[model samples]
Target: MRRPTIKDVAADCGVSKATVSLVLRDSPQVGQVTKQRVRESMARLGYVYNRRAADMRSQRSQTLGLVVTHLRNPYFAELTMAIEDAATKSGYTLFQGFSRDEVPQQRRLLETMAEHRIDGLILLPAHDSRPEDLLETVGAGQLAHVLITRSVRGYECDYVGADNVRSGVLLGEHLGALEVSTVAFLGGAEGSSARRDRIEGLGSGLRRSGVTSPLALSLPAIGDEGGIPLVDRMLERIPCPDAIVAYNDMYAFGIMNGLRARGIVPGRDVAVASFDDVPDAAFQQPPLTSAAGHPEIVGAQATRLLLDRFEDPDRVPSTVLIEPELIPRSSTTSWSGRA
Candidate 1:
């Protein structure tokens, strides 16, 4: 018995092999009805795509290389999974790496992927990645790349993330509604674009509500381990602060733990809020008040952007900032400012 090929699928569906190839690549150029017919023909005829052979002929690997700066944070974990699901469903392969928010390590991993001929790259920039560093390392025209969550030195490229500033605004409004006048914004590093936008949004919201400027406390970056020590440092400021707005829900969880260690009860003694309503945010000791980044949506959108760039590399770059939603819960909304 002989194996059925892309040509067989094309013939069965009465379309040009070029069209069949596009369908196999999940190219958006093909119409839905035709896509369905081609898919059905492939299934019926048991046609298998020779991706490796195709790669050899085209000199392009059908693989996307992904580097997420932090992996232990469940938010990034969820985001990575979403990208994987979208990539697999679209018939592309992915190679994922964690840079642990280190610039040299991220550059090394990305260079290694490029050396292997990865067709594209998806990156969550490290704490100190310059746009020029990336273009220099990978070569501007070498691969179709997309920036996710954080942009690098404001260089234009396919990018997607929750509106951080808007999310900060959402958190501030929630705190103001709770009559919080002096909250401390905790966690994200000083120079992160995401953190800057968040601080801007939060400041704007707090000021509009007659609240004073928030104590902008900085951490090293967004990850698993900085919340407790950072929040402790925030406690040393002149004013004890009305509430705490963490960089993300993971940090909020740590703040809650830290508060408990200090013989203070969160949500009752001081309110708490943060961004990225990751799944665990709700199930915390007291459900968290947070802004939803919709990692699932943002992740899917990032994947589509990269895949589209693969299909049409010359298209103008796009930046998609998904709006965030505030989830008010016991951790902040119910705080009475005393335990």
Candidate 2:
């Protein structure tokens, strides 16, 4: 049998096809009585609305696209969940893509989402590439876009991220408070905004306490297995570092493993601290002292910003920076009953 259509429902209800469309969309413009009548007619005629077609006609997909660099990273995973929850609550659905920290992949994903007519995009850029080109494409396609966790260098866009600099400063101060003279920073790619800001903040914070400059070492991207070799190199240095600050909990874990292989216990022999308080940070041999970025808060804020852009395309882009907190654990303690 032929599927019942909006025309059939309209005919049965003695109303225009437009009325059925409005009723299906739950538009407030349609009177409650009329909506009930249309629904009854739809039920009687077994009518099913074509949501995609309706969305196309209305020029609003009511869907949001999310692009993240690494799906395996706990921070990104938590952020994804928070964004999904907020999107669903706001009567929108999410489509996610993982870019694997590659710029080309990120660009391709943005193009694909734009082609699919998503209402808006929430992107965690792979690096400091100007997103204006992508944003212009989305705008030309009548879609809205926002940046989350990572921001474009020159272009202003709705962005939600933690104050990474502040977090770094806090970490440095914590280490300085312990009077650890020599410290090393490990992990993160070169030219990464998070890396640059964090290192600067950490150095400045340490300087505030009259501590000398801390040595920094870059580790390979997350899960790249380069941390093993990097740790080996650090160990070979004359007079190894007294303390280490990792880019994130994952890197800290790798560092800890490397320390163990060298017969050096993390907390007792050399103190360690990092960022992103992932669940594992708390369960490590000696719980990790780290800076916590509330991914859930960032995700929700990003969703709201994107939704606002979708609602008002002409609104100016805004930047929202959430502060980070420190989670002190056993990782930074010394045998002398000091942290």
Candidate 3:
């Protein structure tokens, strides 16, 4: 027997194929009587709707892609889960990829997603990504996209992320109140907007307490292996840094490891703080002090923004910023001693 299609269901129900298609899509515009008849006919005929064929007809892929810089980082891992949860709840099947902190990889992943005809995208661009690069790969406003985490230099689009500047300021204030004099900011070498805002916030917050300048130790990478060189250079060059502000918990962990090897425990000597209070931050040997970005909330916001854009493409672009909270822990001050 031949396979059943919308046409078959329509004929059996004595209705038009358009009505069957509307019912298949769960469109609310169809009347209740017609909707019931179409579903009944589909059940009687064992008609299965082909989503791919319907997508082709409507020029919609029925898929959305999410691309972030690196999933190895716990912050991104948590953020990804939140996005996935929100996307699934909104009835979307997602395509996810990472750029591996490489520009070519970012371009390739985006181009591939575009080829798959993704209806929209949420991007956490790599350091090397530029507005022109994105425009070339995805086309100029062709694929509805939202820039999350970090916005590209010249690409004006919807964005959602934690307030990096305020987070930095809050972290800095935590350290400043603890009387940290000589501090250093490690990792985050790339010239992304988030990096710039964070650095400025740290400076602004610390300056209020008479700590005018902070030594910026820009590292090429923020992995555990890279932490050793960063520690070595910091110790040799500025041995008296009272505190260290790492880019994220992942970097803070690496720095802590490096400090321990040099007989400098984090809580007792040379305090450390981080952003994105990841799962491990709370359980580290000396719990890491951090600014909580609430990655899940940010992810959910991004998902909502993307979904909203899909509904109203002509809507004006918007930016959503969530402020982070400073979570004090053993890494910055003695866990038990802190009042």
Best by lDDT: 1
Q: What Cα-based lDDT does every candidate model obtain?
A: 0.81, 0.79, 0.79
Runs in model 3 lying further than 4 Å from the true structure: 1-58, 139-141, 216-225, 335-339
Which consecutive 10 residues in model 2 have the weakest lDDT in total? 216-225
Per-model TM-score, in order, reads: 0.83, 0.79, 0.80
Candidate 2 ranges beyond 4 A from true positions: 1-57, 131-142, 216-226, 335-339
Evaluate residue 12 in candidate 1 and report its C-alpha lDDT on the 0 to 100 scale: 92
The C-alpha RMSD of each candidate to the native structure, in angstroms, is 6.9, 9.6, 9.0
RMSD of 3: 9.0
How much is the lDDT of residue 20 in candidate 2?
Answer: 69
- Greater-TM-score candidate between 1 and 3: 1
lDDT of each residue in 1-339, candidate 1, tens digit only? 999876688679897555676787678867899999999999999887787866753666668888998777789999999999877766568999988888889889888998888878889988678878788766464678888899877577888999998898888777777777677778886668888888889988887776775554544444445778776777785445678888888788888998898887888888988889988999997899899999899888888787766655688999999999988899986788633
- In model 2, the Cα lDDT at residue 175 comes to 82
- In candidate 2, what are the lDDT values of residues 1-339, reduced to their tens digit? 999877688779887554566688887767899989999988888777677876665777778899999777798899999999988766678999998877778778888988887878888887646656555555456567778877667766688898989998998888888887778877876657888778888888888766876654434354354445558867675455778888788888988888889888888888899988988789998999989999999998888787666434687789898999999888896523244
| Candidate 3 lDDT over residue span 41-75, tens digit each | 88899888786776764776657899998788888
Candidate 2 has an lDDT of 0.79
